[model samples]
Target chain A: MRDRTRRLVFLALLVAMATALHVVEGMLPLPLPIPGAKLGLANIITLLAIYLYGFRDGLTVALMRVVLGSLISGMFLSPGFMLGLSGAACCTLVMALLLKYTNCFSMIGVSLAGAVGHNLGQLLAACLLLQSGAIIYYLPVLLIAGLPTGFITGFLLNSLLVHDRKSGILRDLVRT
Target chain B: MTRADKILLAGLLLISLLSVAVLYGRFSIFPAKAEPVQAVITAQGKLVRKIYLTEGVNSSLVIQGRVGPATVEVDGTRIRMMGAPCTGQVCVKEGWIGRPGQTIVCMPGEILIRIEGAAPVDAVTR
Candidate 1:
């Protein structure tokens, strides 16, 4: 019982750290001309969660990060918040499922799938909310932008895992 | 690259190329600069009121027809039906729209404002 409690505490701490990263990344602007496009730094934590914990835990952390991140940003109840929420949820679901099925797929492949899923979700939500199918016009640009960003995040996550493995930090965290 | 990686990359490149091509086809390379049209608000082609979009570029024009009051905001290089007494309020929610091929329409007031502008520039022309 004590060990379980400690594990829960550790998980909660991870969630908090991920959420913090989400908010901080959101504040950092991209040099891109598009309004909403960015590096999606928060996704790093989600990818890490999947590697260190599992799919379910990674998904929970992602949803919480998006919800808490939006609330903190004061974008709660706005169309923008809804878009972000839907996008993150769908992306996490798809990525988790893909990772579960394709045992041999690399982190890069999973990240690409997540990026594609994210863009699709946001586009669908925008089309529904705005009642304008014209927003689909943005999809190509969004997809093209998703590639390099997804690869970068995936690479970072893999490197972190490697470092953790070398230091025995990953095993320690898992035990806790 | 692995076979799977190569396939994915190719697919993505194709999609992006197609999107650019479609957009280019729809919009002219060099957009024709438009002289702001002096329009008269009308119902069923009958002139109800006349307002010059040039003078009130940042302001709006409200036309109260038999239905109700119809507010039209004339912004730089564009005109929009800002508000209406209609139930949906869809037009008002459209927000600041300055792009061509975009419009705000109030069915009750029978008011439609088409924002006039040059098409997007093409890279080839530039």
Candidate 2:
């Protein structure tokens, strides 16, 4: 019972942090020359949840962050919100599946997969919504841009995991 | 990073470079086809109209958006979004655009207008 409560509180904390990162990342325009490409700083929290909690909790945290972040940004139900939701959904699912089922990749591999899936999902949304082939070039640009950002996300998550390796939660909950 | 991570990263980079080369090759297929500059407009994911932004041209168009109609005007070689039914009317505030690659997008209206060059934009611009 206590373990479950801990998990719940931790999940809530992850969602809160992820939401804050999402909104902040949206505001701070990184020097990435590509228009829509971003740092994806919130993804670190998603990865953390996946590693510590599990796939379901990880997905919940990710989706909740996007929904809350979009609401906070006042872009509710807008195309930007849709794009963000799609990206978050796809990225989280890909990361969870990679870590849970495959187990072939380290945190970095899963992070890279999540980043690539995120961009691809957003592109799919934009293509279907706008119906313009003009944005096709963004596909390649976003894909290339994913590499550096994914590496950063993966690197950060790894460091955080190492830092927390000794900590309370990892020992409190017996991970499946 | 693990060995598998390196492979994935390298593979993604390869695919990105390949797609860029492929797209550039496809766009340059005509090799300087001197077509006139035009602004393509789409609403509800369908092509609404194409306006050639030639000098001395004056026209007004109304495209239906998700909420209501959006007014667009073309004067000389520039096009501007006049007003939109949506609350923000952010598109209306975009003023005017005449350069290639410039775009005006209204998410609520599901409207997209982009200025295109005769050939695709050069590497630096895009």
Candidate 3:
């Protein structure tokens, strides 16, 4: 149907935007002392997709972003690729579940959970790859960092959602 | 925020505080309790060698790592990576590590240099 096609086109655009964010973030030099810690700016698009569409569509966008982003960055099939995949998977799943089950959590809470889940997923992947639990030491730092980063992204998404709702952009997308 | 959000935030705050407390406790309280005696080298998850770090001793080692060659040097109380084939050379840039629990890892070379018997808690945890 036309509705399905329109939704597909919208999702593709989201994927492209998410990939751009991911690639751009990868280029910046973060001052964090931890090795793998990042702001995860691209997750904003994932959260938006979930809020707009649903879990399946959000997950599709997240996975597509990770894959295509890594390919474009020339890190496909590398350790970084695996880490990104695991983190994005956990982030999307946790956010989707939270959104589905609880109305109590605002987008901020959901974004916080997603960020924490992403860090935990990356930690798990690092431990498995290195065969060392020493990586767990980074957990506290990552968690502490996640709080602020998640809050910023969540705040941005909340404002953006409010504006879109007022403009009827979200409703139009949902209708088509 | 709702009650649920408040609870989640409180829980995360507690965890972060606990982690920071544990890290501080490990570094400040237990540091003087143990002394590091040796440096252990591992490549590809296998033990490559163990070098004793004694005063007035100097040693150097060249390891055939996964990526290429890596060189390590130990001078008296300090140990460091002299050279490595990895692109970043971060291990070499780590300079000298004389403390127990300190580690210099060359990921591309699959080389790890860890100071053993130095601290009661692992450095990563610290």
Candidate 4:
């Protein structure tokens, strides 16, 4: 029972961390000229949760981050929220599947796939809302942008994983 | 680091390059023809008016939106927001748009100006 409570608390902390990242990322001016393009810095926490805990927990964290982030940012129930939710859902699903089904790809490959999935999902939402397929033209630009951002997050995750393995800090927390 | 990772990376790189090439081709080879057709204005999610965009013709409208009055100006083949009560003035800053699917929205004023039947582009940059 204590272990369960601890795990819940830890998950809540992760959710909070992810929310902060999301909100902070929103504040930063995007270097790219494209509207709605972002580095997706908050995805780091999602990848961490997936790698350490599991898919269910990772998905929960992603969903919580999106909802809480939007609410705090005062964009709840808006088109931006819808896009963020859809993107988060697609990213989490693809990353989870990649991690679960294949050992050939590492964290980097999975993260890249998640980034692509996120863009595709957002484009889908935009197309539906605008009632036009012309948004697909943005796909190539989005995919190109996703590459570097995804690589950065994946690299960060890999380093964190390495450190955690050596220190056993995260493992201890999960076990307790 | 793994074989699969290398292959995936290469594939993504190839796709990105190809997309860039396609975009370049579309822009340089066949520039978007600016054939202004008609402009549609909406306020508070309701269609307010539609005006045809023809050369040597100019029109202006003052629309009472949810927040306040917004002035839209249509000159020849281009349309723009001349003035709006919204604080941001982003709509006005959008300048002129004569292409279809391009939109200038003033969220605070709840006004939307969209051009229709212009060159069919994949999407508007802004």
Candidate 3 regions exceeding 4 Å error are B1-3, B27-126
lDDT of 3 by residue, B1-126 (tens): 567777888888798888777755556432433454798999999999988888999989899899998999999978999999989999999999977788999999999999987465445420
Question: In angstroms, how far off is A70's CA in candidate 3?
Answer: 1.1
DockQ of 4: 0.35
The residue-by-residue lDDT of candidate 4 on A16-107, one tens digit each, is: 99999999999888877877678888898998888777899999999999999999999998888888898999999999999988999877
Candidate 3, residues A1-176, lDDT tens digits: the string is 99889898899999999999999998988887766677888999999999889899999999999999999999998877887889999999999999999899877889889999998888898889889876777788889999888877877888888798799887787785
Candidate number with the higher lDDT (2 or 3): 3
List candidate 4 segments past 4 Å from native.
B22-126
Please report the TM-score between candidate 2 and the true structure: 0.66
What is the Cα-based lDDT of residue A50 in candidate 1? 72
**Cα lDDT listed for each candidate:** 0.71, 0.85, 0.87, 0.86
Q: What local lDDT score does residue A3 receive in model 1, on the 0 to 100 scale? A: 73
- Across B1-126, the per-residue lDDT of candidate 2 in tens digits comes to 788888888898899898888776766532434668899999989999999999999989899988899999999899999989888888989999988889999989999999998555456421
TM-score of chain A of 1: 0.91
- Cα deviation of A97, candidate 3, in Å: 1.0
| TM-score, structure 4 vs. true | 0.70
